[model samples]
Target: MKSWTLTAKLYVSGLTFLVLALTSIGTTLWVTWNLEGGAAAVNEAGRMRMQTYRLALAASTSGPSGETLALIRSFDASVALLRSGDPSRPLFVPWSEDSRQRFRQIAETWRQLRAQWTADRPTAQDAARDAGRFVALIDGFVAAIEAQMSRSTTLLQGVQLAMMGLAIAGVVAMLYAGYLFVLNPLARLKRGLTSVQRGDLSTRVEVDTLDEFGQLSAGFNEMAQTLQSLYGSLEDKVREKTARLEVKRQRLADLYEASAFLAKAPSLDALARGFAVQVRRIAKADAAAVRWSDEGNQRYLLLAADGLPAALLQSEACLDTGMCLCGQRRAEASIRTIPIVPDPAVSMGNCQRAGFRTLISVPVKLHDRVLGEVDLFFREPVALDDEDRDLLDTLATHLASAMESLRAAALERETAVAQERALLAQELHDSIAQSLAFLKIQVQLLRDAMRREDAAAMNGIIGELEAGVRESYADVRELLVHFRTRTNEEDIEPALRTTLSKFEHQTGMKVRLEIEGHGVPLAPDVQVQVLHIIQEALSNVRKHAGAREVVLRVSRTPHWRFEVRDDGLGFDAAVGHADETHVGLRIMQERAQRIAAVVRVDSSPGRGCAVTLDLPAAAALEPAAPALGALA
Candidate 1:
């Protein structure tokens, strides 16, 4: 055969696919044309049926013998024509044994009817009337022809559907073949090239076929092999240098991991304990200890010790600054090494002739203040290199940072708590304290009126005290709700509704809470702020607005928006945000700022007021903020 290249193979496969497609369509068309003959056959059979009925009627009635004979001859010709089948008309019964036998019986019955009627024309009424059976036989033969034609039609439809299926199958087969011959090989080559690009020198592509793609794969394997050999020889030349670099890399990795572990230690003791272990491992020392010193650097306390001799650790558990190598004064000594000699006279000053051969102490300091010191003791004599000293210095710096981080976190909590307390105190002074002062003044007035024996004035003072007491009780509950605001991100609606209900109940004002649109709820912290702002708006409505109804609408349109509307005597919202004379509006603004939200008030003096909080789109997807307990 000629060279069987990929193009030739594709050409042959495509040509075969086309031939199969055309053959299927040609078969369908031929079957369709052949079916036309069946239609004509059905027509002739129906005419034979009508002629049989007419001939019987002519013989049964007093018709002329000539007409009766003529009808009989016509029916006989019809039956003979059907028996002789017409290939030119393309009409033929699918003559199964049953149909052939049925036709014979039909022909025989017609002959008997013709013979009986002709034998005695005047008295042949019964025989001629019996022609009904012969006509039924003819009907059976016509039905057989129709059943065959119907089968032919079904076959044609099947051929059409099969052609469609073959077309689809051809496409799928071509695609699958292309994948095997082209896409799969290309993909393999691409992956090999990518691996080589990523520094994989030993990557090789498989060469299975002798096509162009296979040749390409073969070339790729050769290139990779060459590169691998070249790189391997170059690597051998610099093996020592590379080993040193790898050691440094591993050293840096260890320092980073240890620092991460120390940073997340949660407590100072945990930080010290892990730090001691890490230092001993990285320094390759036998024993290690961590000590904390006072700010004055006058005394040191053992915070954590690892692999230390029990007797030595117990004896040197606490020490004054400059007592030993580990507790040296900050100015006189930095990170220093000391040789441990077997000195019997130095009982407590030295290790008392323990197994330690050398001691390397580094200060865990932040700036000039020495927060702690890490002591490394080795059983074997070890020489210190500059890199080893630098490693120790980095580990010490990380320990210092970890300590400071813990202190800063503690300070932050204390600050939030202090802020919360201040806010509580201020809210109390504004609400309940003022209301109590008013009630006290009313009580004094009532006492004076009673002493003077004035009934009307005493009654007025008592009513005033009652109203003041109710107002003060309501204010205390509102403050409790405000300070206790806690919720999950999904419970924004529930929290807002709770606030609205409380406002409605405390102040005999009708509240309408409506939720519209749809979206994921805001972050938990954002929801907390939103709930608080809504509560503040409702509180303003209750205190200042003299209207009847309040409507709080919460909606999410890409971003979250909350609106609190009231029907009370609206204050000039332009007069700063809903009576800015009070600290409530200021608190609302601060809360909005924390979660990247905006607060606005729309109102006129005679009309109602509406306070809307619009949170930006990006803020909704944010994770919940750290729980800063209701500072509002």
Candidate 2:
């Protein structure tokens, strides 16, 4: 009736059924005992009547014999037991007043019959009549017990019917209670669980009672709410991660494209313009400009500009004086954002007039040295965050590196041109110029001989002049061949072989070229100069040494050494002469010195000639020699 736990309800129901079963058992046992008691009394009364008849017959027939006397005693004991009211023994009977009167009459008849058998030995007719009356009374007593047993049987049937009705009613009540308190709520909970299993987190058990089911329902609802909240938060986190991945992917693509563009740009201006365009696209800015320091002129120069108005582009105040917004910000040596305000000192009035609202300046730095600044302009007042600033800073760094590379390339080109011109001038002065001067002197001699009217001298002088002219023409052709020779192969061995083959073919002399340390590489400029020096040595051997055989040996150990040995009619080195041969020797020495190499001439008048050039390993690998100033 009141709210209780499931355990308490079950305990109470079990106890009630136990009590009802015990009551039914007790009632059935009591009714059965009363019925058995009435039947036993009837049986006792019938046995007593039969014993009294037998005693009467024996007395009438045998004239009070011993058998008759024993029968009388036995009969008397049975009647006394029937009349006793002892409740302990089953044979004892409790009788009403009418049954007691009937039992007394039977008892008195048995006594008269026993007295007649013992004292007078009555006639057979009297004895028979006495027996008849006793038998009739016994029958009446049995009839009374039978009637009482009938009443007990009817009461037992009534008790059994009442127990059956109570058992049926209890069963019905138990089933109904179970349905209301247990089965119905269990079904509801089962349905709610099914819904939740199907992903319906909104489903909740609606049981509202102060019981176990109520507490279970509340806990289930709390769990569902927690799950829903967690699911929502997980979705938010996934979306945030997806967005971040997309942004990182886009940034990677932009960096890749920027690196490709910057690498191929040919000059500083082109690199700057390309870099500005890429940065503007990456940062989503309106305009971009690059300005670099002109240390030579002590001013900053605008290298390139993109998407800026013509009026602002034409303004030379920023270029002439380092008073512009980017120039002022370059001193900070970091990326910064500035508002484009009308300030004369800052020189941003042109930017303001051009409708630019904000400026993001990124200093182009190389190893902590600020070379320039890249300026990004925006129409709206924009605040540049760290990510935006970092992007611009990276672009500026790449731009700075490209600019440095271009500068180095331009410097190398100019140095190469100057060196070539100096080499050409020295070659002309040493060979062709001297030969032309000698030819002029020979012509002067021929004119003098002709004026003196000596035909033999004039003819000899003409022969000398023709020889000089031929020698000069040969020198010019040799110079042309040397200058036209270019080493296009990646390795120097091929070029060396080509030069050796040409020398062998032109001079009609056997030239032996032996190379050691075959794979050792020399710098491009070093290889070129060494080859030219070798050519010069070979030429000297051909023109002056008058040698039949020459050996050109290029060996590399700790350093490189170029040797040209000739078994020629050698010249004396101690006696110096201002001749074409000495001039050729001087040109060879100068070529060797250009690469920081040392040259040695081992020769005598008639023995042989051995010219060797030894180069340091470092100078061969990296030819950082200064320009030749004045070669004597």
Candidate 3:
């Protein structure tokens, strides 16, 4: 009647059926007890009647014999058994008024018959009549019991039929109720679940009653609604993610293209123009401009411009810090965006007059240092989004890196030119210049001796002048050979040997080259400088030291060391003489300084010269430009 959970409903149904089954079992037990009692009574009555008849026959045939007395006693005992109600023998059926009266009459009749037989020996006719009467009474008693048993059997059969009908009806009702209340609802829930598994979020279960099944159905419907809402929003989230991935892919492709273009742009101006074009295309801007900082003159120079008016490009070619929109932002070293407004400031007037409504200025930086700024212009009054700003920032960074690389290359070229000039000056001062000066002094003395009209003096001076001219000619040829020398091998030893052999052949001097720590690495620039220093020292030996032999030793143990010692006339290196010899020493010192090396010239007027150069081990191994001689 009341709403119940599935478990409670099932329990109640089972309890009701159990009660009915117990009732039927109890009824069956009662009927069986009554039938058993009636059967026992009928058996006892029959036995007693047989004993009475036997005793009467014996009394008639042999008046009061021993067997007859025994039969009488047995009959009396059986009668007492029927009459006495023993507590041990329980009765299943209570004795009704009719049954009790019939039992009492049978007991009384048996006692009367026994008393008659015991009192005297009657005639045969009398005994036979008494026996017959006793048999009749027992027979009537048994008939009464049989009738009672028949009634109990009939009642038991009816009770069995009734209980069976009730049990069958209860079982059928229980099964029907289970199907309606539990099975049917479960089937509906299963169907809904199957639908949901097939991606049908709209499926829902019907709530028939306020029971567990109803609650479960309600929860399932709620879940379906939630799933429907989530499924709908999932599409939007997926779309958002797809769009983001596409943007990132496009950005990566743009960055790859820009990097390739920047690497091969050739010049800073070309790089700037190419970068501006890439920025305009990637950022969807109407125009773009690149401006570089000229810190020496304190001006921002317009390096390149795209999609801008000629007038504006000319006006903005060069501007001082804070002179215009780009310059003002560059001075601050920050990125800025100019929003479109009716009363826009005149600082961006040039861009506005060029049909640009919005501007974004991004500072191009190498680390924290700003090299320049790139300006992007839009035709409409469009606000820049974060993606656009990010793109511009990336472009600016690439531009700055490219600019730094170009500047480094230009510096390298200038440094090489300066080194060549120094080498040329050193060569002239050490070789041709000194030789020519010596020859000029000889000619002057020869002219003086001839004017005195002294033949011996004139002849001696002429011979000295002839020797000086030959020596000068030899020096010029050596200089020419040195200028054309090339050290194509990575190792400097072969180049050194070649130079020394040429010197020996030309001067007719014995030269020796010895190397220790042959595998020690020397920077190309350091090696070139050391070799040139050794050559210059040898040249000085041939010209002034007048040494017969020269030894060139190169070792690399604790540090790189080069020594050029010659057995020739040595000069006082400490003397402050404005001479060509000191000029060559100064040139060697400058060459050592370029690679952070140390040069020591040890010599005296009478002793041979030992020139040594030492370089530190930790210097960068940058390759120097080939010597001027190689260039020639």
Off by over 4 Å in 3: 1-91, 94-246, 296-299, 330-333, 419-632
Tens-digit per-residue lDDT, 397-457, candidate 3: 8888889989987876676677667666767766677767887887888788788888898
Give the TM-scores of the predictions, in the order they appear: 0.51, 0.58, 0.62
- Candidate 1 lDDT over residue span 384-461, tens digit each: 889988989889988988898999888877887887788778778767888898898998899899999999999899
- What lDDT score goes with residue 420 in model 1? 79
For candidate 2, the per-residue lDDT at 47 reads: 84
Candidate 1 Cα outliers beyond 4 Å, as residue runs = 1-257, 281-286, 294-299, 307-320, 329-334, 342-350, 353-355, 367-369, 384-391, 453-459, 490-498, 501-527, 544-548, 554-561, 571-606, 613-632
Best candidate (score: TM-score): 3
Off by over 4 Å in 2: 1-230, 296-300, 316-334, 341-349, 365-370, 443-459, 514-519, 553-562, 571-578, 593-608, 612-632
RMSD of each: 30.7, 10.9, 8.0
lDDT of 2: 0.78
Give the whole-model CA lDDT for all candidates, comma-separated: 0.79, 0.78, 0.78
Quote the positional error of residue 153 for candidate 2 in Å.
42
Model 1 clash pairs are: 547-568
